[model samples]
Target: MVSLGYPEERFEDVLEERRCNSDLLFSARRFAPPTYKHRCPRSPAALRRAVLDSPRLQQAIREMAGEDGDTEALRQEAQSILREMGHNQGMTVVRTFAFMLSRIFKALFRHVRVNEEGVQRVQKVVQECPIVLLPSHRSYIDFLLMSFLCYSYDLPLPVIAAGMDFQGMRLVGEMLQASGAFYMRRSFSNNPFYWAVFSEYVQAIVRNGDAPLEFFLEGTRSRSNKSLSPKLGLLSIVMEPLLRAQVFDALLVPVSISYERILEENLYARELVGVPKPKESTSGLLKAHRILQNDYGSVFVYFHPPMSLKSFISGRLDITPFSMTPRHMALRLSDTLRVLVHHLAHSVVLRQQHGMVVTPWSLLTTLLLQAPSDHLFPTSCNSEGGVHLPDLLHDVRCLRTVITKIGAMQDWPDAQSHEAVVLSTLAMNSSLVTLTKEGRVLLNVDKVDRPKCRDDILNRACTVLTCAAYRNHILHLFVRPAFVAMAQRHAGSVEDGPTFSHFCFLVQLFSEEFIFEPGSERKDYEEGLSLLQRCSSLLYPLDSQHHPSTITTNFSVFLGQIFQPFCCSYQMVCNYLLTLEHGSMQKESQLLASLQEFALQQLLEGRSTELEILAINVYKNAVASLSRLGALRRERRKDGVWFLTTSQLHHVADAVASLKPPSQLPAKL
Candidate 1:
């Protein structure tokens, strides 16, 4: 049996249960597709010819020639661009690579578990309609995993939309192209010819239904490891053909992939702190291959139910043009596409969140992050001492119960399973965590006695940040409970506590710090209340403002601890913004540099944890949030300079700083 990267006894029941009862269509030969030689129609060469000979494209080209000065040279330029952007969907090559990659990846990881039912559902959808596989973006392996899953299921492979970043990798790029990945320029809005060819090429694929299309709606990997607000660039282009009735419709499948350990966790965290990321290149790929000898835990892939565009637009008002015979009908949809794009983008995020898989690493990270900094490691093996194993187990049970009640524990495990998972995870990550001879878990932080090199020091520093990245994967699931605990801790007693409205205000205020989904304030409030009721009898919302509730000794340190670092970091960003010149514009790069310098100083002085508090990406995102809140503005010319929009910088700073959790939170203003 292949390693599933999980303890067999713990996972056996769940996997077998799922396999037996799965109602997925065509389940007989679903997970294992019969392997055979086949050729995909509509090859890259055929797609290019169709695009060039397209009447709509020719008209668009002609219009460009007259209005934008396009000539025979420009026409040839368009053809060349098409050739450059197109991909060859060679089934034999895809199959060969898929088989080889499965072996290579299995050797690299402990387990790779795909939701067999999910794959079956995707296959069923593809048989009925065109599919758009919209997966979350966090690592480069995202598209590779999607393609491999489809190939393994014997379903048609997707024509993946890849960024131009990979196009520079000569042999690798060509191999990717041959394996059904198409290249797209980062920016091609100014080049009408490029746009024409690219649009037509995409339309040809969707219109033909030769294969399903796949791309990350987030556009690029998120350094913070959160689902970024979706980028609508490719989505808009892909939807154009369906909107114009050139194709029947497409099914958008939102896929969420969870890694027991991320390959780029430390690198992503480093990039967040303003460390320059090495460019993706063939040489870099080769260099990274050495790490395959090490074990990465498990990989989980979950596919949400497919959403049809036709059903989505069923009750909505038609943004389509009234003129059915208008020239460039397909391109006309692009003008008013933002509304549709925004809807789909938001849907993708919610679906991705819903489909997220929770593994032992995620659960363990959550527990460790929430524990008191000192108690994170057991001091001794004695039962009456620090971080008792039973206490930890109880806490995990409570967490699993509450989160499951709140609909966030899709993959929650039973006690035996949970224990197995914890033990297995600690064993796998012994360098970062360990089980004492008495079975007490302790974080491994004490340095080795031997002399260390510079690289070793850097690796040790990255350990915390990589752990933070793992913690972030399940962070959103704990938001409501965190908010409730923060509120309870902030209030001295129920009599002097905040009102429900005030708590809601704080949730909105600190939205960006935790990447709260838009318009979820009320839902968060209700869930927080549910958690508070379960965790403590001392805290309860008052029926009237006149009769305030009471607070007790019972409270969750987990809520406050998990959010403190993020809250403190956000306050630091706001404080730095106040130091900027009033009403004066400053380049964002300059602002980030100043923030990084200040953070470095704080780190040197032992006043800050650099990973959580000093990351430049966090500050950059904070500024963007402030801009959304009308606290700042950006220049039009794309110089990345932000203008201080309000004169009340001090007031804004104070407001944000007040939302910090109680342990680190200051007295209420």
Candidate 2:
């Protein structure tokens, strides 16, 4: 049930990969019956029309129209909006495109491997009840891939909740519509008419159970490639059916799509660093056709076990959307739904439930990004010219052991041996890894082109960003170890590991760069401390005190490299935060705006390209962390001012100085 690799032509390579990694493949057990083709009982167009004609929707339209004092006019307006927002379920077209797009994807990627077992679980859920497939949004291609994956598995194609961006592309829009993609604007909080029409359309689809539903919980692709705070807008609208009892039960399946390389990594990096995003258009898509010619390595689709709404709210509390007489009432109960939406989105980020695929490329990229650019070869391989394969192998084993101990790899039972996993990953990513004439290994990220123009400069920038994006896939897993390493360096003695209070203080400092699991601060602190203890024990077994001297210097160096970029990013942000006028409240957006400018200025001043120091996502995270620590406080939700505490500023400055490696930053703090 491991990913069945892409492209029939490369089927042989898939077979060879399986043969080598057979020890780690998912069981080939068919837990369910072979799935037959499923067709929607009602077309999305028909559902929209029914909702438009529903008495409840008509009443809501009339109520809104009365504000302008024109009920009939508003009714007509509502119908027009419904027509614009509706999705067309062209069954024949969907089937045709499914066949064609499969070929297209196979052509685009070196391999496309679907977790057979995960897909089967989803298929079973499809038969039992309605499903809302909430996958992480990493690329525009996610929308198509979700539907395509369902279609390939003989399950009914999902009605994808896509953004209005795609709706503007004529042929592309029409094709997407024909294949069951419904478009919604990024915002409609002011447009009551559009909101009613859109809400009804989603509810009708869910109620009818004609097709499984799909949407990105994040609302848009994350430029940083990490999970963003979830946007509750669409998820709140879609869950109205369950709230109103129109559907007895709906399963929320959080999907994790891991790519060896992102298709839009360079463009995303550009946007992250303050380049205005180019709007999605037919011409833009056509211009991007060059992507198909390039190899994008492999894509993995892992479906986490689904969550039931009834179970999610069990024994906690209840806002009975049940008491509401109609589906429209559920939409009006925004606060209740928002709480539920947050839980659903947060669950998607929780590692225990999220089905993340850890590939060799991710592992290797982590090592490469962590290692100093100048120190590309292992210390033992100083006379050699390539990568130190043995060191990498050991690190891979260590990472696998760490993740396995924490139960992150439980879903993929076949990924048994860490060595096999690393070997298989290297074999699959043959293009990225190579041995030099001196028999040393090196990642080929240094193929710099002399930029004669802005386009060339941007292109090289994108290349590095794409590589960083891959490394980021495993970045979260390294957070605690990195913190331990950095904190130890600051302690200035290996024998004296930071006190629990000091370690927790360090966690607070790096909060912007890593997301710890949600719990009481004490629980998070304990978990971090425990992980450090485990890692220290594994490396320095003879001495359990986590003494720096007892730990192998090689292991210590590896941990330092892992911790460096985050520290660099933190130092840059803290420097900016310290400059803010004490007691002067700053709006979140305004604070981030200033920080973004500072990041760009530093980039121009020659910052390391090894990490995304200017990343807006990390900047926002730092602000959130500061707020949690009482260094900043929100004055009001919309007041747009975060009160900065001068007293807490000193602590932040101190933490930043301690974590900053002397080699990277000046000694003066």
Candidate 3:
């Protein structure tokens, strides 16, 4: 395993730095980058013209219009598409927005820490090739934060790909465009003309190599605070320039951003349980200024070393087909290249996860979720499943040690006492947690003045889901070990062969929930096993025949509880699928809604206590896993229809049930 690098200064407070260096934000000399040798630099208008005149796009337009159709009208339609999809980055607008964002961020956060060395490394690479900045999408502030980092470091500002939702906001939309954002519609699969225009616009950017390109590989923000599966559409477009050898090489930088307190925590929780997100508008942006009154602890941004696209595909891919085909013709990716792209995307997410800075709040929340609940709300709240302050401090200390031992960057200060760190963290997230007069920690749902009916369930859900979101920050630290522990329990023995097989199965089942490097299942399994052995969770005897392997009692319980919520959530999804009538079809939206209602009913009846299971993302992943396993199939239709294969559904249910620890087994199961 690679040892994690520790920052010498730990974190540099952006506000403090700004105060020390008064001219840092406004008076620095920005770095100037050279254009790619493949093509001369073109203005935005010239770039649009080039895309419209490209042979590939022209052919697509002709095919869509047909020989007898109005070709002139189709050409005009393509021109309109180009106008809607292009960016107009003005230096004056960039500087004006930078100043405004500086004040807004200073008011919202106490600190924003960045790795100086990482920025310097990127600066060195920017001079040599086109740079692609791939940052994890967790909140709306992500793109703004990236642009700010560039301006602060004097690095070339990146041209970001944005969703059309932002394009409708009056005034704000145009300002964002002027500061370097280009908009695209959510989905345009049926519109070949729009697709042709969008593809060409992105290719022109890559081929020019004038500015760094930025886009979310996940395609959308993660409401659950975990990594979402990569969206391959934009990723493929960027790689096309490299695949066709139009540019010598391009640098792909995976960036990770960690927030101590998210600005959209409550909004995200509400959306997870079926609430529609409010539309983006100038009015909404103005109203959101109220959040600045509160203090958000800190933000950490880490820019990983750049990866060379040419070196990555050196011998693995055969680009001969791409080179031989005319540039005017559409080239489909071969099976091998597609697999390579999938791996590359997953690798970026893994690097992002590894570079995250885990905090004390994350550790405390994780343990809080694992503690048993004796009725969602107890009268006394001083004992009986409520996490006591003293006990929580001790457990958090242990968890921090274990996480550091496994090589995750942690943010605990060496000089502070454990009690101080834990208490302060709890104070910062007071909306989700509270302390009683007797010093017992409890969920803060009771403070909200909601009617005691269905709203009560939702109120509690919002708090639970919000807490779970914080816990997810450190989940990647324990996922592999937790998987190994659960597999051992299911296999009923510690034999390497059976345990490893079960481990592989669990990895495949939860691939959507967790990010595992592709084609590295065997390596990941060995890493998990070795960690378990080091922690004394698993013991391997010198003489296998005489004495078999054994799992330690204490460590087994610790690891098993880490994944209990996930296992219970998957089981709930499978059980719901089993109740559906065989061959009866339901729309995808209807199914998700039904599952949420079903989960709520279980919670009210005391059949389940895992509120985190109510998350829509989890349900989506469960449905995807079922479909992949042949337990559910989606029919080809306008709205799309899903039907269950009764026999296969039962098999999947049984498989999922076996992974739950014996203590968590439902009575019906």
Find the candidate with the highest lDDT and give its number.
3
* Tens digits of per-residue lDDT for model 1, 259-301: 7777887678677766799888999999987668777866767
For lDDT, candidate 2 versus 3, the one ahead is: 3
Q: How should the candidates be ordered by TM-score, best one leading?
A: 3, 1, 2
Clash count (model 2, backbone only): 10
For model 2, residues 167-211, the per-residue Cα lDDT tens digits are 889788888888888888888887776777777777777777767
The TM-scores, one per candidate, come to 0.82, 0.77, 0.93
Model 2 poorest ten-residue lDDT run = 4-13
C-alpha lDDT of candidate 1 relative to the true structure: 0.65
Q: Candidate 3, residues 1-669: lDDT per residue as tens digits?
A: 112555452345666766565443563345454434444766777878989899888888788878798878888988888787788887878888777777778888878888777887898878778899999999999999999888877788888999999999999899888888999999987776788889878988888885789999999999989989898888888899888888888899999999988999999999998899999999999999899898788888888889888888889888777877778877686788789899889988998898888877788877777655432243443243356676576566666667767778777767888898888888888877777777778787664322235687787888888888888887887788778877888889988888898898898889899999888988998888777766543322232221111111345556677677788889999888888887767888889999998998888777887777888889889888778877888676776666555568888789998876634321100
Error at 42, model 2, angstroms? 3.1
Candidate 3 yields a Cα-based lDDT of 0.79
